[model samples]
Target: MDRVDRIRERKREHLELALTEASQSRRASGWDDVALVPSALPERSLGDIDLSAELVGHRLRAPLLIVGMTGGHPDARMINKVLGAVAEAHGIAVGVGSQRAALEVPELAPTFASVRDHARTVPVLANIGALQLIAQGERPALGAEKVARLVDMVRADAIAVHLNVVQELLQPEGDRVTGPLLPALAALVRVAPVPVIVKETGAGIDRESARRLVDAGAAALDVGGVGGTSFARIETERAGVGEGPFADWGIPAAASVLECRGLGVPVIATGGIADGATAAKPLALGASLVGIGRAALLAANDGVEAAILTVGRLIDELRTAVLLSGGARPSDLMARPPVLTGATEAWARQRGLLA
Candidate 1:
C-alpha cells in the first residue's frame, strides 16, 4: 500500500479499538440527569409507533440513523458494505465515512460507493471534511464545481460537511485547521447541487452557530455530540497523546440537539448513542433523528446480521418509547414530558431549553 493508504488504515484501526473500549471508561453522557418519565394513563401499542422521519426531503423508515464510521481504507469498504446492506434491510439512512480518501485515491471510491450499491432504498450521504476541502485551496473559490461531481460518483442522497477539528488536532499526521470557516461552508451549500448537511464529528454545534449555519444554507445539522467516541480520547490512546484537557471536549449528544433546536434546519443527535434509550434521548431533545456509530462498528465485527439486528432492536426501543409516551410517531417522542435534573438538566437550562 502507498504511504497515505497505510496511514489511513492505522487511524481506522485506532478508532475501532478506542471505540470498543470507550464504554468501560469514566466518560458518560450523564444521561442519568434526564429521565423520560413513564406514562401511567392509557397509551398506544409499541407496534403502532411510526418510526418514519423526514430528513432533507427524504423519508426514513426508522428514527435511527447509521452515523458515519470508517471508509477510505480498504478494510473500511467491507465494513461499509455490511453497514449499507443492513441499512437497506431496515430502510434507514446511512452516512459514509470521510470521503477525502476517494477524492484522493481513485481505487477507494468503490468501497464508499458500495453504500448506494447495497442500499438503494435508504438515503446515503457522502461525507467530507471542511478542513480537507479548505486545504484544497482554490477549489471552493471555483464554485465547488467538482464537488457535485464527487457526490454524484457515489449517488449520495446528500453531502455531509463534517467538522472534525478535534480529531484533526489529535492525530500526529493530521492536517491544519484555520478559523473563519463560515464562508467556505456557505460556498459549498450554494455550489453543491444536493442538500448540504453540516455535521460535527463529536463536538456538537451550539445555538448561535446553528443559526448562522442555517442562514448560510445548511439544510440539516448532525450534532455529533460528546459522551460517545471521544475522538480526542481515541487519538490520545492511539499516539499516547493529549491535546491538553481536550479529551472530554464537546457538547453531549442530548444537549447539542436541544441547543441547536429551531435553527431553521433539521437537527440529528449523534455521539454516545449506543442503545435504544440513548438513541431516543436525542429525539426527546428535538432531534429529527438519532445516530449511532460505535455500536454499529462493534456490531459489525460480530457479523453483518448481528449488526443489523442490534440496530433493529434500537428501532424497536424507539417505537416503544413513542407508544409509552402516548405518541403515535417518532416526532411525537420529541414533545414528550421528560423530567430533567442534575447536569443534563443544567445543560438544557443553561441554554434555556428543557423539553
Candidate 2:
C-alpha cells in the first residue's frame, strides 16, 4: 500500500483497537498515590467555584483539555465534528490526532480540518510526530515551514509535536533514531506561527527531557505518562505479538507531573485521568490542565450528545472536588496541595524531584 493508504489503514486500526473491550480495561495512572488534603471547613459554597483557566492566551471554562486521539480517515470527520462541538459548548480545548497522514495526502486534509470547522472558538491543537519531523532531514527550515502550513490547515491555536519513541519501537513499521530530537523541535518552534507544545504519546516525559524541550522553546508540556493507555501493549496486540513486560513501561502520569513541576512552563497532566477526582490531583501537583483521552474517546463513540454529557459529568465532578478541598476556583485547587505517597513519592525522591 502507498503512504496515504497506510496512514488511512492505521487510523482505522487505531479507532477499532481503541474501542475494544480490552482497550477499555483499566490501567494505572499513578494518581492514587497523590492524596488531596480535605478541609474540615471548606468555607465556600460549591456553586461559587470557578473552573475557568487560561492557556496560551485562550480562556477555558474549565482546565480540562480533550486530548488528541484520531483523524486521517473518513470516519474521523464525524468524530472531529462531535469532539469539536463538545469543546465549543463546554468552553474547553480540543486536539486532533497527528496530521502527518493528512499532510502526506492532500485529499485527506478535510479529515483534520473538520475540527476547525466545528470548533470555531475554542483552542484547537494540530499534531505532528517528532520523528517524522526529524526524518525530513537536512532541511530543518523547510520542515518548519511545512509544519506551519499544517497549523493553517486547521487554524490551530497551538501545534503539538508528539514524542512517541516507545510506541515507534514497538510498532513493526516504526522508525528507530539515535540522533537528537531537540534541535529539530527547536527549528520547528522558531518558525511555527503558533506556540509549540511538546507531548508524550504514552510513556510520559521525564524532568531532564522536559527541561530540554523547554529550552528548545516549547510553550507547554503534556506529560502523557504511563498507567493510562499503554501504546506498547496496543501496538503489540495490533501486531499480533501478544503480551510482553514492555506493556507497563514508562513513568506514571503523577510522577511525571512532579518531575516536570517548577520548570517555568505550563504542564498538562494526562494519561489515566478518568474522572474529576483523578483530574483534580494533577492540579495540586502543579499541572495547569488535566487531559482525558480514552474516556472521551469512549464517550464520543456513543455519539456527540453522549460525549457532551460525559464531559459535563466530569466537569461537575471536578467542581465538587474543588469545593470539597476548600477551593473556590480551579486555580485555588493548586494551592490545596496533595500528600504524595507510595511509588509516586519514592519515584520523586529517587529522581531528586522532591526535597
- TM-scores for all predictions: 0.92, 0.95
Q: Pick the lDDT winner.
A: 2
Candidate 2 on 1-355: residue-level lDDT in tens? 9888888888888888876744432456679899999898898887899999977899999998888887889888888888898999899999999887776678988988888898999999999888876653342423766787799989999998889988888888786763578898998888889999999978889999999999999999999998887778778878987766677678889999998888899999999887998899999888999988888887888898988999999999999999999989877877767888999988888998874
After superposing candidate 1, which stretches have Cα over 4 Å from the reference?
22-25, 136-143, 242-244
Model 1 per-residue lDDT tens digits across residues 127-234: 878775564343333247558756886688888888888878877777665456788888788788799899998788888888888888999999888777777777
Model 1 scores a TM of: 0.92
Residues forming the 10-long window of minimal summed lDDT in candidate 2: 135-144
